[model samples]
Target chain A: MTAPSAPLVFLPGPTALHPRVALETRAALADGFLSESHRSPRFRACLVAMEEALRSLLEIPQDHRILIVGSATEAMERIIEGTVTRRSAHLLNGAFARRLRDVAVNLGREVVEATVPDGQGFPGSPDRFRDPGVDRLLDGAELLAMTQNETSTGVRIPPDLIHALADRAREHGALSVVDLVTGWPSEAVDPARMDCGFFSVQKGFGLPAGLGILVVSPAFVERARERQARGQVTGGYMGIPALAQVADRHETRATPNMLAIRLLAAVAEDYARQGREALDGAVRRRAAVFWNAVVDLPGLTPLVEAGPSRSRTILVVEVAGGSGPLRDRLARRGLLVGDGYGPGKGRHLRVANFPVQTDPMLERLLEGLRNEV
Target chain B: MTAPSAPLVFLPGPTALHPRVALETRAALADGFLSESHRSPRFRACLVAMEEALRSLLEIPQDHRILIVGSATEAMERIIEGTVTRRSAHLLNGAFARRLRDVAVNLGREVVEATVPDGQGFPGSPDRFRDPGVDRLLDGAELLAMTQNETSTGVRIPPDLIHALADRAREHGALSVVDLVTGWPSEAVDPARMDCGFFSVQKGFGLPAGLGILVVSPAFVERARERQARGQVTGGYMGIPALAQVADRHETRATPNMLAIRLLAAVAEDYARQGREALDGAVRRRAAVFWNAVVDLPGLTPLVEAGPSRSRTILVVEVAGGSGPLRDRLARRGLLVGDGYGPGKGRHLRVANFPVQTDPMLERLLEGLRNEV
Candidate 1:
């Protein structure tokens, strides 16, 4: 499945680098964004502009501070390091969610984990946590973390459930961190409601991979700042308070991926100009294009049968046979989508409904699945 | 003095994006390096090839393992985190060298630091650390770290002196870590001798900022691996052993800046083709062009007067009276170099001798100094 030649990438995370976004890299060079100093006023301006664009595109609350790190994986570590003092809880259903749990464990913190098996939604499925247990899970925990849209299994914890849990965690003195890696802008997020939410631009912004954005609510920042002010140990560049210290100046402590930051600013501006409703509708429409065709496609069936828990960004499907056949068929038509993640690796297919996967490619994918599967 | 429109950047770090290196980002998009999964074979192959090119260019020994990180600053944090078990010693004379010591301190390690005043070199300067005291610096240290070419001070610990110190550290059971951030292929390095050498791609490689490269000796890897195997706590993604585990398979634990990695590989390959002599000669030639003009250029004088301890890469000069007037004079001619780092910010000048500063730019800079200064 190493189709470096494929013009279209429908993989859940990377998706496709939309032509508009791809051209931004060229613009970065033309405008000398590459050679600009990280300490310069120009870089500061770029940071301020990027923050504004991200705020407009994602409707981030005014109280949250946005940080640029390496990847969502990095975001998970920094958040856990900065926010959690002792005990942290995780709701896991897929590979990425588990990665956060692993990050905490590696950091030598107490971890409490609740899991729903692959191919099942956390709330829509029969059972993972009882109502009372949900209360117990947040109790005495410093932080609670989960992925909003699990890219691996195409299962989404309902947004309302996320807000509910955030509220519950707050009541129990726990901060909630949401990893909305593969779904942003299209999957509306309120940083205030979630407490702390982070995502990678390559996933939904249709840009090259590298930089990660972590948005921390005022409560989250206050908690971390309090901890730092109390003389608790902190990390270096990626440390919570260390990053926040420079973020106030519209700068990063270390030299960042300037070109990527510039590209995100440009792409985020594009999304803002396209209007949030139009952007979200495009995502919903393309996802529905695949979902509606599931009945006609011989072997393909939606992974999350419950519409309430299904992900509109990363659409997971279970082929009647192994996913290999359908994936191979699609490869023949020069289309590439992600194979199953974690336990579902070889048995399922994950298709991206990112803004970059335009109609022509979607049609090609649908035609390939219909005729060949 | 950010000259984004100068068409040339002579700054110390993020020197200048060579035209050849800039084109590689475009190649990345065309080849789908951006869309490819980090865990895929293609990325593995890219890593393998990049390692090979880097080895050839830097003359890294076969026993060393190369790692791709976010920045040299990230490398400082990770290296200090992984390698030092209890105590570390630092030979610091500049801002960047102090950064490593600070990283160790943040990680809660016992730090023994030795320092010399600015505008003076370690070996060339008289009376910083006595000969007997020098022995004590590395005596009980778990690791000894220093910057080979202090980009901030334009001072260098000559390679032979570095080897002497590394050998002495080894005798006392300590590891050597070198931050040749702004000097690499241009200033030769031996990973076996240095133990650990890390640099940012934007520096000597003449590429966009984002990625850092760390080359570790076999001993460095073995020590970290043994610690991990013994059930000692390690980091998550950037844990020495965790990174090594995937480095074996030629992949990063997280999705890296693939485009930056590709550009480094391409630039390294280009240097290999140009041969090490030509590459190093180009750097020396540029530095000599500036060093030779010191007498003629009225306020600007080489900061490190001792040629043996002076950096051929980051040429630091103390501006008589102040650097403001001379910097403005050069600015009018559309040339931009770095301002002195740390305390020397407004009083000294730092010009880069990176490969991207071709003869024409060098001539323009020299002419500006002669006429305007």
Candidate 2:
């Protein structure tokens, strides 16, 4: 019945939003800053606050710059366009991994395809760079790209693996990029290890869509400038250097998504105040609650098993009779989980364990799975 | 001292926001649709509703398509990238007009420049084609582009000028594009006349900055596809055909600003109910209050002499001293107004008369100008 009109969202990408975000958003709306010119000192402060909050929360290094973009898709486009000139290698294990490959291809870059089957993980588990296929792809590549967490499948190749891949790319004399689209806040994507890493706020930050966060190393910035110098398109109005130039003034090249950006700063500042360890504990605690509830249902089991590859934030379960019926039954109880992504569409149900989803909400969701499903 | 903490925003852009838009934005944030999947039917409906509301409000013809972009700057990039292949003719007078030419040059397109002095608009009041320089710029150009309303200099080339320019472009076997960024809602940008027209919502729409509206004709769509066929870049992630394809499904290439989009739809629906004439009368009425109060101020006068060239929605006055002193003086009284734009930086003060700016707000601002300045 349309999920009881006001259901708790559990989608993978634009997951459950915190009421605090909504409250802060409303407060921002009421303030005069909502209508402030992006060039104003007040607007500049908002951008600085957002950047500083994110820096403190993520412990981002001084050398890495945070560039705000339109969306994660746009982030992907920007990273590939701004960084990769001739050859880029993609590690495709899921839909989003393939998406990077697609973005690179769309930009007419030479893509070195490295893929595993959709449901399968790299043979070396978390140490994917140890795999021969990945090694082959990195060879002779100008840049290597992979998703730190693949939302399409409930596969997360932890931060350590991203670090390892970056090291591998460096050994091969290539830069590295990471797509942490659904794996930030809950998981740290250490930017120091890679040339670039990016995500959107709607996934883990409990904010609305429309903001893309790109963390680029100084070398990466140089590479984008080099691309521009070489007569390659480094983003026209959205050119990497152009955005960075205005960003230094605490503004954007084009009018940015101010509402979403401000809300993100508030949320990030909240997380920083709470500290990352507490956030990690709470996230783990909530995932356990949902994982404990849904894993043993009749003919239903956790996808990716419990391993290094399993996602901590997004929990996916494969249903024997397709996800539609189970999701429909859950919908009847006002619980809305995500449908399977791509190949797993009807066969899987993806549930999120973001910080915004409180314990009691998870309990209610668990009860829905137990009694309703 | 800081504009009384809640000054009315009368900046040329990101203008005074309406409380209705704030309320509607808050409502949208509270709703679960904020976290809903962009692929969901509910999200599709939001897209459709926004499109329909705009179509009804702008009287958009059947052949024209509405594409939602990141910002008006992005809209300009998309139109130039999607439609223009080789050579483009730019009619420039003010900053934002020069911006399109900047965008074209940035995209590596061949630009033929035509211009009038900043304060002095085209020789003929409404019809710019009477100028020999404008006539020459149109010849042998693949596309003719000009700003319908120059936000920087308070000059508006009326709809009739745009229509006449479009006729000239067609006669020259070229397409015409118009930048109605600060002009829309207060001024109707008829999609039926121009091949492409665009604006951002933060202007006369009385909303926060983020969303951009692009209305493209069928012929314009065909031109974009043809550009893509010839292997020209038509916007990578924001490719016009790709955006149009998703738009048909009631979605965008990127995760859109659902909050802004929904609020815009609500506002557009509200305006549609009030009818265009009511909005026109209200805008003009509000302008009169501020204009009458400021026009005869000591050593102050209108920027554009008087007549068809002057902007009605954004009323700019030439302050004898740099606009800073007067703006700072008014700020002490909590009535914020726009400073001079670009080359006019210190010499002019721009005041907006959007529907959201109540008569009392303008009265307060005028009183500040009369008594303080």
Candidate 3:
């Protein structure tokens, strides 16, 4: 019952995986990458390189522990479930934000959802977190979880607001766990400055899906150790301790999607060689190209107001007059975009503008959408 | 800083990923597997095929619910943590068996361990499950857990004993969860009658390492739902409900390693067209071919006693007289076998004889082992 092969063009994160990276992945798999001892100097070297590459990309200091996991969702759930030993507040602005809250609640943690409109992103100030309900909610809370870039909606939560909240949460002895699933070097958030930050590999690193990169402060590691001591340790195949052990060996614990990991390293190298500033410039340029094109399309309305607050990797577009058939028409023409998530579902589509959002590809997609509409 | 590609040959359980699978995986990545909806008929069809193929391979009833997850470990943990609401007795004869026990205990279940020598294989009597300690442990216990095939030490637990243990646990109002990480068509057991059975795609189906196939009985599923209603659901990426929903879809919830899934379907089709008896016979024949060749090799001793009770898919060899680098010598000959895990660590090397354990491959490995010794 497995489906036959189908040709697809991506308007999603990191678009098509880089061809060279893909080639390296195939070569590594063909050459038998999994059999190597994870602790071998070569594997450990890969781990060190991966950590350094990501550290440089995130503009983080060397002391932060970087563990690469299977996906952003895995890291998000692990951090929330593993680090949050008691009650916590989850700041929700979009679908992924709500997913974080759900993860906390599912883990049997006491969770209070701090709400915001989907398209509005997170509120611009920390005043919203100062309410009596919020204070009561924070009474026994041990963590404040939020998302930096809500990929479900084209909204970006400002890092300053995040830092502000982190400071407040700290006053109540709570840690901050951020789901920067699509934010990283492109947006220039320093991981060392935050308690814990995570992002998806496919979105920011211009690689294939399957790998997630997480940066945790040493404090988070101590908390994890405490959880382990309390016999509350949950084994995520991608759990941070397991990941750290594997990362220390510069290898994955299980046979990773070797193809994806290899491609990720190659993509990281490509970024490093080009320099972070150059990569950031490329991302900004690509986002501008795709966003501008989507704005000009007759049947589509930009989902976010023009400002620095908007996501640089995803462009949310509302089909003019809420036409589902029009969206389907664009999809049929090989312009695959994400359906709006959460409250915006059925009325919006998300177009990714990460590093893989090439000028030519975006132009072609825009032309196709126009012609189809 | 990706490491240089080495020419290491994996004895392959985490076997050398097939080049064809890797090729298709690259194709999947380029074509966008993640961007597709899970509920789509295309993915659902894949799920159905995978489940059917698994049932056919294991000779299980159509009524048994089949679920696929990231790895065999995830499935094992879910089954143990989900069903066993109280205490449990764990039968430990190998590394993976102990891991199952660890998972159960870590989830707040009281675990009573039943011990056996690492290389001796499972005891012959069901009375072992009726031990006073085991009986006492089952007072408030919700299940008895054990591994079918001890992949680490090449010991296959006796099915009658396992069935007896399951019956005893059920008599005490408990369930039975089996970590059949290596058990497959090597022997026959009716999964419909068992509470839960788990396996990884790599060992038996000869697929990549990413997909784990889990089959469960109606009794266990009902108990899990009851627990969920009580808000006592244990959370993990491998939670039973989430896995069940994906299982119901016959699709993986997260972006599956698509190329591997597709390859698994193709491999399953190969086995199906060839018939179960033929495939099982082939696996048995391959095991004999290697076992016979190694039975008299100089300085090599069969770790397990010779009989049908031994795991046909894995042959554990102990160095004769004393341990003096026999495993290292074989590896030098490009024959990659597993180091004895846990108690057997360093004393034995495990050679797997799964579906991919082809005649030529065995002949070459044996010839190399013979020459080296």
Candidate 4:
């Protein structure tokens, strides 16, 4: 009468929910946590717990404030609106980075972009921050935006490069914001190094797709306050000043996704219990295994050039002919991988190496890939 | 090992999740709907089905469009940004109405408000829209905003009054928007009469708290286009044009709460099966029972004036002493009613009489109220 259960999903994100987190979310739902008032002390406790857990797991600095929002894209919009006054520069190499640039443009900000091919990393090395060309672009920009992990192409900007760019942006009197949507606890990056960074819970956290966790340094808050003082239209609900004021009291400017927030807190607590190094090591081990298998596969090649450029969390590979048949075969075999993003659709397969991916699931996926090839 | 389950929550909102909808949501979660890509046809079907179900249940006209957003507050922000070019007028009777007014002000619009005290309804009768005083306020306004059901005060504007005011706004070349956050389907108001009307899923829909359904008329869309043509900011992710374009394909502009959307579709489908008139009649019957119980209870008086002004969905009562001890007594007995909203915090209690309130639950709440008194 009823259809069979669907296979475990391994798509880029929202990735498979960790069973423990799912159980906690279910209990929360049944206990009426979702129905509690956002202004209630009960809900505030959830907020406080979530923030503390995330801070410990992400290693967020003491001065940084964590604001929960609707999505990572919203975080981008908020950061740009709250901080950018006159000009902003973007390092665009993939779809997500280009979206940040477009959001700035849509909000009427003056935007300067340094772009590279989709699958390629940002141009030049981290040392290029000293180059005059890079300095020229950053000169008058109020904010310099970059994607730490570009979900579209599975390319990661080296941590050294991100830090270098942030340092250069600071020299130019600009704040730097990074999007870590697909790369977070799995691949630890110091939140203290950037002015602001954000990620959605659906990616590395292996939760549902509603809540976006944004980390804002005190300097970023100061910039937002300056904009507010100038009576600029920072934003309405997504305004950083409003968000910070409410978050200070452990609340949101608007009603948030409580179930998702609770689930994230549970997941974050789990991560903290396992210890960050252990979790990151497990993720790295899984990534290594996945990368090795793809490299040995008959007709597949990594999307990003090998070395530090490839993302540890998202594995993208190009299919020699087309990816449709292989994807279909894998799907039939109960293994799911993401389709190519944007232009690469049908030509590449993107797989997630999130911490939640168990060894058995990975082995099954590899077997599926080998058989399909 | 675990603490006892939480009491049944009767908070104004996020209200209790209907058991049927909860079951559907849990099944959807297990089926991996939450993990599906926003661009996937699977997710699009959920969106399309939700819109169609809501349209059928709410009697939305053919020319009207429904856009799903993050919250009712977001719907307010989006409508204000998308429609109001320079000037807006608000009918402010309670906290929610004032919030709409504030949103316009925050977005930098010239807001002219016609205010009344918190416990009272809008000034004058429904026929007052025909009076010159209301016309004078609507004259130069680009958009006129009003709350059909002011959740904060438990005061609902009569359907006739809402339609009349909308007609007046149209005559004045302004679009009219209504906040039906706590009231919809429970009290059937024709959406064809207003340019826009919105509601959050947590209230009458008995789903989770993440999604807001916004119904937009063709006139509102045309006004948004005019604003866009004038180079005004129509919002980025919350923009009407972008939302409508994506909604045309049965998708949201950004990642949406898939679990909430699916649950809403299921609930709407159930409502449709039961018939709107029948559903509305059941709600009216429940409201009658609730009001009668409140009238009979000791040390209690209805907050809203008795005749035609009280909200059927949310019943507000002022207690003789403070409401704290009474609320505590109810909670101890496994009954939960909302604390008064805003200024009424310690002196009043707000109870929801939504369609999902079962007969047994109502009896328990009524019994609890009597015992507490």
| Residue runs of model 2 more than 4 Å from their true location after superposition | A1-6, A125-132, B1-5, B125-132
Per-residue lDDT for A1-373 in model 2, tens only? Answer: 1234678777876777866777777677767777788888977888899999988988889878889888888888878778787789988889888888887887778899767776566656446467786678887898988887788887877677778888989888788888888777768667788888888888888888888999888888888888788877776588788877776677788779888888898999998897777787888888776677666667778888676777878788898878898898888777889999889999998988776667777888888888755
Clash number for every model?
0, 2, 3, 0
TM-score between predicted and true chain B, model 1: 0.94
Interface Cα RMSD in Å, per prediction? 1.6, 1.6, 4.0, 1.7
The sequence of per-residue lDDT tens digits that candidate 4 reaches over residues B1-373 is: 1135557667888888777765786686677777778778888888888888888999998779998788888888889888887899999979988888888888788988898888888766768778888888987899889888888889988888888899999899989899999878766678999899999888887777788889999899888987888887787655898887777777787787878888888999888888778877877777788888888888999999876678888888999988999999999987889999889999999998787777777887888887879
How big an interface RMSD has model 4? 1.7
Give the distance in Å from residue B231's predicted Cα in candidate 3 to where it truly belongs.
2.0
Q: How accurately is candidate 2 docked according to DockQ?
A: 0.64
lDDT measured at residue A227 in model 3 versus the true structure, 0 to 100: 81
Ranking the candidates on TM-score from highest down gives 4, 1, 2, 3
Candidate 4, A184-271: lDDT as tens digits: 8866678899899899988888888888889989999999999889888777665889888887888888778888888888889999
DockQ of each: 0.68, 0.64, 0.38, 0.65
Model 3: DockQ vs. true structure: 0.38
Give the best candidate by DockQ: 1
lDDT values for all models = 0.81, 0.80, 0.68, 0.84
TM-score for chain B considered on its own, for each of the candidates: 0.94, 0.95, 0.87, 0.96
Alpha-carbon error at B248 in model 3, in Å? 1.8
Query: What's the DockQ of model 4?
Result: 0.65
| Candidate 3, true inter-chain contacts retained | 0.24
Candidate 1 residue-wise lDDT, A10-96, digit = tens: 987666786766577777766776776888888788889899998898888777889889888888878877888788999988888
* Winning candidate number (TM-score): 4
